[model samples]
Target: MKPGTLHLIPSPIGSNTDVLAPYIRSILESVPYIIAENEKTVRRFLATQMSSELLAAKQFAILDEHTPFQDMPALLDPILAGQDGAIISEAGLPCVADPGSALVQLAHSHHIPVMPHPGPSAIFQTLMASGLNGQRFMFEGYLPIQEQERLARLRFLESLSSREQMSILWIETPYRVKSLFASLCRALREDTSLTIGQALMTEESFIYTATVGDWKKGAIELKKSPAVFAIQALPVAAGLRSNKSGGKAVGKPKK
Candidate 1:
């Protein structure tokens, strides 16, 4: 039998897979073994696209942070044996910011075919709704948790965004969302365009983009919600004018 492919499946970020492509569903149906960040989550996702019988028959291997690195090599045994296998995350694409990237790297080192299926990503979804500089943006993932270091990091990212005319995107743990927002409000200039997307792709989702001054007028309580924050780069003069007139700062032109 030919060497089986290692499919990098993109699971839904939210509770439902309504945003996933039809082909992604078909790919999941074809794979019998899945290397998941969390077996329960992957199983739940599979249940949505498959029959209960097929779901029960599917084999799973967990690959979260707690999993030992040395054990990763063994996870690919099924794929190496010519059995098509998949790598999935609790939400979104397995490795963009998840642990599944390690497996993908291993697959490449072994000359195994790796396939990526397009699906919904909270990062992209947040950018889409953020109305920021989507054409020239960087995903910084999570920021420093230490107060002083985090403040310094935020300043650096803000300055980088301003200088490069690029949007700086980052995330924080659910419980720390409010604190991060507060830090952003404190550290960023009044003119900088700040955006926050909460519970994206869901009914309770909220996305708002405005100047830092605007955000301060009446900041929404983030509570313990999953959120993504972005800062749009703007020219100094334009940003000043927007701050004065209560208007949006001009974002970088998509060229």
Candidate 2:
């Protein structure tokens, strides 16, 4: 029997299901099996796009961060046996920042054809509106939670951005949004440009770009919401100069 294909389905990041492509329903309806980050959440989302009977009839298997590597290959047995399957992320595109990548890799090893359906991604959405260097940017994902390590990583990223004139992007959990913003204000150069994309694609979405110095002048409550942060350091020749204290290039001007 011919090996079945694997479909990569992107889920909406927010309450709006309209962001999903119109062709997604047909893909969802055709797949007999699904691998998802969270079974409950996937079922909840499918309820919006599929009939109650159809949703109940679909078979689901979990493949999240906690899934052991040994157990992953079993998730593909049905597909390998000629039954088409789909992978759904908890939010946004599958396998970008999600754990679905492991299974996708396994599918590739077995020569299973993989098809990805385009949909909303918070990372690109933020970069598009950031007004930063769209030509060159890197997504750093999540920073270290330890204060000192996180600070060191921030400074290193800033230095790299300064030298290369590239943008750096990362994300934080909802509860840590304000805390991370505060840390960015303190750890980065005052002249560095920062962009905040909060609660994107939702009713409460807020996106703003400003220098670190400008952001420090006012206070805004970020509350607990998903946010993407981007930073572009001022070019070395623009204003950055060698620091006398640390012997490193400093982007902030002496106050």
Candidate 3:
């Protein structure tokens, strides 16, 4: 029997399922075994995308941060037996800032064919709108929650971005959005370019790019919103500051 292919399926970032290519449905229909970060969400997505019948018929194995190393090896058993399988995340593409990568790595080691289907990704959507250097950017995922470690990481990434002229992309849970934004405003240079993409693709979606100093001046509320943040390093002088409406700081173009 021919080896079964491993499909890397992408889940919806927001309520918009239109981002998925038409071919994705066919791919989803082809596989019966799925490895997902959240089985419930994946199943629900399948039901919405195709049919409730598909959801009922499919088999799932959970693969998240809590999934054990020992359990991973067994998860590959179905694929090794020439059964087509898939990996999905709670949101966005699989294996990205998600534990699904381990399954992909294992699939590669066994020479199982791994195929990717294009779909919605919050990281790319944020970068596309960031107005930053999209050509070169880094996805740092989530920063450490610990204040000291998080501050050190912020400075390190900032220096790297400044030196490399690359955009730094990261995210935070809905509840911590405000805290993380506050931290960025404090730790990053005043002139650093920052883009905040909140509630992307949803009715409440918000995307704004401005200098750190500019962001500090505005009373933007990002609490309880899923968001992606992108920062572009700028020479302190080149990244000048401007005032918003009422003497509030705003990002000025790099000279």
Candidate 4:
């Protein structure tokens, strides 16, 4: 028999209401308990679509980084008693460097079903459009909040790009994009390749992927852009373990 269910529903990246009507119907009809990062924010965002009354009647609980682990039992008992719970982060997939992991771990240990409802994900989209080597890429989640730690992280990622021959995805808080980009240039090799994806799927947003040397000389700047950066570990090559290196890469130029 399947264990009591837990769902990881994908909310929109930056906007709420992007989930299609069929998806809304499916979630509303299926979920008995809703675990959200911010209930009021979600309520307002969903109100324009799902309406106020129904969303209210369906109770939601707050579960973020601060929620005590001991308190999880209280939340878990109700869920495991056959209440199918849905966890929605503010944006994108839960537990992708987000706060949904502890609850997920609790659910898995208790033999609960942890299902990921597939939908929009920016990281994959960035990699796909990046024109960078995607097969051996690593998503490092986000850059650090502290300057010292953030610089350290950047250096580490740059080393990963040089030593591993694997692409690395770098993310940052929206406000600090310029600082991060500046720091990235300092850390990476002039010829090291980088891909920048900003405000994906939106008319105002764009992506620019290229090498660091060209990036410094390019007209495009990510200073004001909300972006996800994917850095090519090494020049693109056919075989992963093969010692061959320095094959000239072919990719679309960024505008």
Candidate 5:
């Protein structure tokens, strides 16, 4: 029997489901089996897109951080046996910042085709609205939680960004958002550009970019919510000019 294909499906990062295109729904309906980060969340999302009867008939397997490496191959057994299957995350694209990359790699070794569908991703969306350098940027995912260690990492990223003129992106848990923002304000240079994207793609979404000095002037009260942060340090020449001018460097205005 011909090996079935594996679909890499993306889930909504926020309350907005309009990003779920019609084609994605069709693909979800076609697959008989699914591997997801959270079974309950996936089922709830599927229920919004398809009939309850159809959702009820689908088989699911768990694939999160705790899933053992040795057991991943078996998750693809149904697909290897000629049954179409998919991998979905609790939010955003699978295998990006989320889990399931290993299984996708195993599928390729077995000669199974992998197809990725488009959907909302907090990383990309944050970058898009950041007003920062889109041509060159890196997603650092999450930063170190330790206060001293995190400060070191922030300075390193700031230096790297200044040297390369690239944007550095990372996320923080909702509860840690305020603390991370506070750290960014303290550790980064005054003229460094900082962006905060909170609750992106939803009705309550907030995105703003400003210089570190400006952020310190009028601090915003950040609630405990999903957030992505990015920074773009001044280029070497710009840094020197700003320093000579008493730290008043023009940056992309807050948006």
Candidate 6:
């Protein structure tokens, strides 16, 4: 049996082809089959760009959270039997916040080889630029999208940022970004600094690092650029605000 390989291709966040050129060509020439989150978007992007290399008479299958579990046995059987395939997420790196965990677990259970091709990922990009503490950080992924769940998660993240002294990373739906930032303004330690990165490594990008108090006073307008954010943990200063209040801390740290 031929040894099969599973490649994780990390597509760009926004529409940028040049950044992904080398990887695209490699996949088209090498892999016989491809799995993707949105087959239509991939087709549309190839068509719009008039790229014959990646989408020229190529066949693809849609894969997502709803991908039937029963089909895994048959689908992955070929790979175990040894036919190489590539998996592409909607954006960023696969298996991060993306829904490739189950497929990966399947591969592991059967001892199939899974290889990754490193590329741009929003989570790491934000961390690199956020000026937050990358040494000890937590990637919280997307908080609950619904109001109650979102707030609950936000409250927990807020406490972690203040008390734990760790960088908190998060992403929200583009449209809800303004409101999410507003809530953070109401739920974080004062003097606690946050770095917000929007569209990292792409056109129309922006990054801001500032305190929660400055944010509440309209110092920064989040509406202009929606983004992934990192709130760096602060030192245990002398004037610590009540963890529940999440307001500004009033003084410097004790020596």
Provide the clashing-pair count of each candidate structure. 0, 0, 0, 0, 0, 1
> Model 2, residue 233: displacement in angstroms?
0.5
> Candidate 2 — worst ten consecutive residues by lDDT sum?
246-255
List candidate 4 segments past 4 Å from native.
Answer: 1-3, 16-24, 48-51, 146-148, 223-225, 235-255
Give per-residue CA lDDT, model 1, range 78-100, as digits (tens): 88889999888777777887887
lDDT of each: 0.81, 0.86, 0.82, 0.72, 0.89, 0.70
Error of 1 at 239 (Å): 5.1
User: Lowest summed lDDT over 10 consecutive residues: which window, candidate 3?
Assistant: 240-249
lDDT of 4 at 148: 80
Q: Which stretches of candidate 3 lie over 4 Å from their true place?
A: 236-255
Q: What is the lDDT, from 0 to 100, of the residue 22 in candidate 4?
A: 60
Instruction: Give the candidate number with the greatest lDDT.
Output: 5
Cα lDDT tens digits, model 3, 45-125, are: 887777777777888888899887778988988888999999887888888877778778888998999998887878898
- The predictions' CA RMSDs to the true structure, in order, are 4.1, 4.3, 3.9, 4.3, 1.7, 5.0
Candidate 5 C-alpha lDDT tens digits along 75-175: 98999999999999899989988998999999999999999888888889889988899999998989999999999999999999999999999988899
Error in Å for residue 68 of model 5: 1.4
Could you say which candidate leads in TM-score? 5
Which regions of candidate 6 fall more than 4 Å away from where they truly are? 21-24, 44-57, 224-226, 238-255
Quote each prediction's TM-score.
Answer: 0.90, 0.93, 0.90, 0.83, 0.95, 0.83
Candidate 1: which pairs clash? Answer: none
Put down candidate 2 lDDT per residue, 11-104, tens digits, no spaces: 9988899888888998898788989889999999999998999988899999999999999999999999999999999999899878888889
Q: Candidate 6: lDDT of 72?
A: 62
